[model samples]
Target: MASGTGSTEDRSYTERLTRLGGARWKQVLDVQAPYRWNLRRHLGGRTVLDVGCGIGRNLQHLDPSSVGVDHNAESVGLCREAGLRAITTDELESSEEMIPGRFDALLAAHLLEHLPEGAAADVLRPYLRFLAPGARLVFICPQQRGFRSDATHTVYFDDDLLARTMREIGGEVVDQSSFPFPRAAGPWFTYNEFVTVGRLADRR
Candidate 1:
C-alpha cells in the first residue's frame, strides 16, 4: 500500500511527468486535448480543488481559479514554479486558501488506483471539508491497461467501485463514462479512464 507520504514515490513520479512534459508526440498532436476537454466540460465550478494533482498537469488545463495538492513536495514545487497554485498535502491541511465549504468541486484523478480497494474514502476524507455541500465530486481512475502500465497502481476501478467510492465520500452518484473510447476498449487502450461524477448531498 502507498503511504501517501510520497517519499519513495516522489523521484520516480516527478521524473515520469518531466519526461511526458517534453514528449515529442505532444509537440506534434496535443494527444491529450480530448481528455483535457472532457475533464473541463465536467468542471462547472469557479473554485476547484484538485486532489493528487501530480506536477499540476490538470492545473495548466483547468480553470485558473483551481488549486492543486499533491503528496509529493517536488511535484508541488514544480507546480509553484509553473505559477500554478499548488501545495503539498501537509500545506493544504493548514492552508488559508479557502474556508470550509468554499470549494465548488473536488477532483481526484488517477489517485484512487494507487490505494487498495475500499481505500478511496479514507484517502479523500481529509479533503472533503473544503468542498461546499452541493459540490461536484469527480473521481477518475485508470482502466485495466493503464492500471497495469504503472507499478504503483494497485486497483482497477470500474463504474461500480467508483460509484461506491463517491457514495462513501458523501456524494450521490449521478453519471459515469469511459473516456476517449468505449468500455470494450479499456483493456487495449492505455489512456482509457473511468470518469464518475457525483454531487454532495445538502447538509441537514
Candidate 2:
C-alpha cells in the first residue's frame, strides 16, 4: 500500500489509508491495530524495515527503532506527523550514503496484493540480498474476501502461492496461518489476512 499519485483512484486510496486505522471498526480489525501487540513476540528486538508502510499503521505496533519506507509522500508525511520514523523509497534509494544495507527483519503487510504476478518477487528479491543471515521476512496476503474488498488489489494468494513465492525468492517458509479470524469471516470484514513467515537462507 505504498503511495501512487497517478490517478484519482490512487488519491482516493491515500485518503482511505490515512483514515483506515482511525475508524472504530478498523481499529479492531485493520492491519495496524490488530497486529500491534501480537507481532511483538515474533519480532523480538530486531530493527525492522517495513516496505510500503502506508501511514505507519503497522509501525505503531513495531519496536520504536523500526523504520518504514513508502512510495507515497502523503503516507510518509502522515507517519512523520504521528512521530514515527519513515522515508520515501525514492529518498532511501537516492541517498545511498544514508540508508542501511541490512536489517534484522522485513515486513510487508497488505502490500503484495497490489503488485502483479512476478512483480512481488521483484520487489522482495533485492532486500533478500541485504538481510542478515537467517533474518526473518514476514508477509500478509489477503484472502478472497479481503482481496475483493479493495479496488487496488491486483492479485490473490492462498497459502500455496504465498509459500511458492517465498521459496522462489530465496526464502525458507517458516509459518503460514489464517490470522485473527477464520476464512469464513473474511467476506464480512476487511481485517482477515494470510500471514506467511520466511527466513533468509544461509549465504555463507
Candidate 3:
C-alpha cells in the first residue's frame, strides 16, 4: 500500500483524491487490494491505530474499532465523510481524551521515510504510549526504487535500519523482512516493502 497519495496536505489534493478513490471506486478496489485481507485476518479482533492513514485506505480492511489519524485535515474529513472513524493529528495531540483507548496494534504503513531520522523518533515515541503492553507495532517503509519514486521521501530504510529505529523507540523486533515479493520487484507501489514487526516492551 502507498503512503500519502498526495505529497502535500491541501484541499486541492483532497478534491483530486476524492475523485480518484471516491465511493464507487473504493468499493471495487478494496476487495482486490493485495495483502490487506490477510492482514485483517491476522489482526483478528484487535483494535488498531493507523498513523498517517491517508483517505482511510488501510482502515477498510482493519477492524471496525480501528481509529485512523492523519496530519492532513482534509484527509481526515474525507475519511469521516465516508463514515470511517478518524481524527486529525492536532486533535490527537491537543488532548488525551481523543484517543479511544490503548490500541492492540499500531500501523505506520509507508510513513517513516518521509521524515529525517530524529524527527521520526520524536513522532513515534508519543504514539507508543497509547499502545497496550505487548501491543504489536508494524512499520512499512520504502526500499530503494520506491524511495526514489516520491520526491517527498527523505530517507530509505533497509531491514537493519528499520530494526534499529524500532529498537530505539523501545520496541522489541519480532520479525524483519522484505515483503509481498522479492527485492527484484523494485520499491514501488504493488511491490516491495521493508516490513518490520515488533512489540512494545511494557513501556506504558
Candidate 4:
C-alpha cells in the first residue's frame, strides 16, 4: 500500500529517514560514502535545487551553493541544522534562491517514485522555470528491490516511466544508467537505482 500525500509529508516519514542503522556506527563506518560520491559525480554545477531533499542526505553531499526543498518541514529543519540550505514547498517561490534561471542543475533523488502516475510531471514542471534553459535535471529512482523497502513508494519509475515523466515536463532525456551495479542487480540489491539525466528544454 502506498502512503497518501499527507502521510508522506508527516514527521514520521522524516523519522524513518533517520533510521540509518545506528547513526554513530554508520557515520564512523561512513557507509554512505560511495553512494554520496556517486550522486556528487552527476552534479557538476555551482548551484543546484534539490527537490525532495529528505533530511539532506543528498544535499549534504552537494555544493554549498545548492538549495533543497521538501514537503517535510522537519526534514527541512534538519537540513538547516546540518548547515545545508533547505526550504519547505510553501516557502519555495518566496525563497531567495527562486530567481529565474537561478540554478544550474536540479536533483530529485528517490523522489519521483513517491508520486503517483501523473504527479511527477506536475511536481517537476514548476521547478523547471527556475532552472536555466538548458540546466541539467537528474531523477534518481529506486529499482525493484529497493522500491519494496519503502512503504511510501507509490509507483516504480523505471527507465521508461522516467523518460515519459521527463518528456511531460519538457525535458530531453540524454542518458539513463544503473548506478553502482548493472540492471540485473537491481532486483536483488536494495540500494540499486536508475539514474536518469535530462536537460530542461529551452523554454526561452
lDDT of each: 0.84, 0.75, 0.75, 0.86
For candidate 1, give the lDDT: 0.84
lDDT ranking, high to low? 4, 1, 3, 2
Best of the two (2, 4) by lDDT: 4
Question: Candidate 4 — what's its lDDT?
Answer: 0.86
lDDT of 3 by residue, 1-204 (tens): 223333646777566656655568567766336567546644657898888887887777788888888888998998899788898888987655345346989888877887755577688887877788889888887677777766567777778878888888888899876666777675455447788888888853
Expressed as tens digits, the lDDT of each residue in 1-204 for candidate 4 is 344343678888888888763489888988788788777788954589999999998898888999999999999999999999999999987888788898989998989888886788898888887898888889998898988888778888889988998888888899999988999999899989899998888877
- Listed in order, each prediction's TM-score against the native is 0.93, 0.85, 0.82, 0.92
Candidates 1 and 2 compared: the better one by TM-score is 1
Give the top-scoring candidate (lDDT).
Answer: 4
Better of 3 and 4 by lDDT: 4
Total backbone collisions for each predicted model = 0, 0, 1, 0
lDDT, model 4, position 156: 83
Error of 3 at 35 (Å): 2.5
Per-residue lDDT tens digits for candidate 2, residues 11-127, read 566798766557777556654545665567667587788888988878877878788888788888878899988888678766442344467788988788877666888887756
